[model samples]
Target: MGMEQQAVEIVETNKPVILQGGCLCGAVRYQLSAKPFDADYCHCKQCQKSSGAVFQVWMDFKREQVTWLKGEVSEFESSDNVRRGFCKQCGCTLSYRDTRYPDYFTLTIGSLDEPSLIKPNYHIYTSNQVKWLSITDDCERYQQERTS
Candidate 1:
């Protein structure tokens, strides 16, 4: 099953009026008011290349809720539907958005104001996951395309 069918979305909070996050060199920072709509791990080829790692963990929230608090970012248009934001100084990824999904943007889990609050509900593209690294938890795993 795909994420749309298997993943259960957790309702976000409205009362938490603030969340803080920053880049590696602290050159860029961001703030958000709404809780994440989805937190998941992606193991796609693009994610591997973008992060220089096996996978990427992300926390998605409303685009309107995110605010740049410290510095500006240089963006790259990844696709017709998505544009990525990163700090030019430290090359730290802050946020990303899909033109088709204009209402929300996904942030790297590491960029969370408090990293502890982010909880991944699923892992996508497990077919390409490194055998040496493992996830011991019970989150749902997709072998290939999430829609498969």
Candidate 2:
């Protein structure tokens, strides 16, 4: 079957699907036991700086759902309670975690083996988005992080 057909089958089956991904240098690899949720594009300054892009696409998963299949990521305390993970060997950004929400974990959409499987449902921190960037998507926009 084609890629689209395979994706549809995975969703229709309603079974736990493991998504695999890794860093640029292949030094770090991981797997998600469950499908990710709350996929969104973040335009926050932190995300822009960390990703070196106009915005960063991130998806949320439960901490328990993540497994380090290969090497572990080195974390940097980006903010008071927020830490970002990267592959030390290649310096590829991999994940994010906020100590305040220990149960939640986030992964960069670009790092996924099949990045097209996840789609951004909304945009966050739009207020900080670059002035030159124009987002025309119909997805919901939040001036900052979503409270609900």
Q: In the order shown, what is each candidate's alpha-carbon RMSD?
A: 4.0, 6.8
Query: Where in model 1 is the C-alpha error above 4 Å?
Result: 1-18, 145-148
* TM-score to true structure, per model: 0.81, 0.87
**Model 2: how large is the Cα RMSD against the reference?**
6.8
lDDT of 1 by residue, 26-76 (tens): 988888777676677888877787777888888777778788888887788
Identify the candidate with maximal lDDT.
2
On a 0 to 100 scale, what is the lDDT of residue 2 in model 1? Answer: 15
Measured on C-alpha atoms, candidate 2 has an lDDT of 0.84
lDDT tens per residue, model 2, 30-89: 998887756789999999999999899988887999999999999999999999999999
Q: Which run of 10 residues does model 1 get worst, by summed lDDT?
A: 1-10
lDDT of each: 0.75, 0.84
